[model samples]
Target: MDARRDVFQAIADPTRRAIIGMIAQKPVNVNTIAEQFDVSRQAISLHLKILAECGLLNIKQLGRERLCEAKLEKLNEVHEWVAQYHKLWTGRLHALKNFVEQEALQPRQANTDNKKKTKNIHKPKK
Candidate 1:
């Protein structure tokens, strides 16, 4: 798979998602991260490998133990994509808001016009 696709695929799993959240909160070793999940340490190691390959996790070799930290730079692509859709929805919502306001005012205007018409029709000749 391509680099971006690999990253997206790796993140699609709930276990991987939880791992990312945990690492973002604080850097920890594979064993520490594995404790939080029911899976084996080896499975966690595999997930870590995918995350590291995807550039989402930074792995540092601190002597014998490797620590993992959330890299987050690649995540900006997700932010930018969502921001584009946010603008489109915001515009649609604004249009809906304007339509609702105009619709609400229309009844009041019709009532006022009816009142004026009645006053003009029933008035005694001066």
Candidate 2:
């Protein structure tokens, strides 16, 4: 059985996420990717390795250089996960809006009723 690593764990590091973003635009060699970061080449290599293991990247050897390419399909998992919460928060916000509108209307309605009661009390009986 192929054990799939969690894409979230691989992308948890800021460097790894940056690396993914960099390669997403186009394929790049390890040295090119390393140059963009403050970290050492070894550190960048480790990040690349984690990303590959998580299925977020595809590394290939072309001539002497190892090229890293992004396999963005893996990100669909992350998107699906976030979409659930997006829907939940949207529902919660709609409920909050309805509550606020109802609260606003209640005060106006109560004030109108109170005004009518006050006018009735002050009026002389017919």
Candidate 3:
């Protein structure tokens, strides 16, 4: 898979997202991360590998332990892409606001226009 695709796929999983969220709080070892999940250590390792490959996680070895930290800067790709639409959305929202204000200024019909008086209808002899 492409690098961007791998990153997108890695983040698509809720467990992986939670792992990233946790690491964003602080750098932690493999075992610490594994403990947070119900899956096996090996499974967590695989998820970490995918995250690292996507540049969303940074792994460094300190003595015998590998510390995984979130590399959230890579999210700029997504941020930049979404920002392009932000301007367009802003314009559309402004237009919608103007439209709503204009509509609200229109005159409203009286409620009695919708109500029928019993005297207006023909009545059967009792």
**Regions more than 4 Å wrong, model 3:** 1-6, 108-126
Per-residue CA lDDT of candidate 3, range 10-106, in tens? 7789988989989998899988999999999998998898888888998899999999988998778767877989988999999999998877765
Model 3 / residue 27 / CA error / Å? 1.2
Q: Give the C-alpha miss distance for residue 107 in model 1, angstroms.
A: 1.5
Model 1: what TM-score? 0.78
- Model 3 residue 119 CA deviation (Å) reads 24
As for lDDT, the candidate ahead, 1 or 2, is 2
Question: How big is the positional error of residue 87 in model 3, measured in Å on the Cα after superposition?
Answer: 2.8
Better structure of 1 and 2 per TM-score: 2
Q: Write the per-residue lDDT of candidate 2 for residues 25-118, one digit (tens) a residue.
A: 8999999999999988899888888899889899999999999999989889999999999999999999999999999999999999999999
TM-scores of the models, in the given order? Answer: 0.78, 0.91, 0.73
Clashing pairs in 3: none
lDDT of 2: 0.91
- Residue-level error in angstroms, candidate 2, position 63: 1.1
Model 1 residue runs over 4 Å out of place are 1-6, 115-126
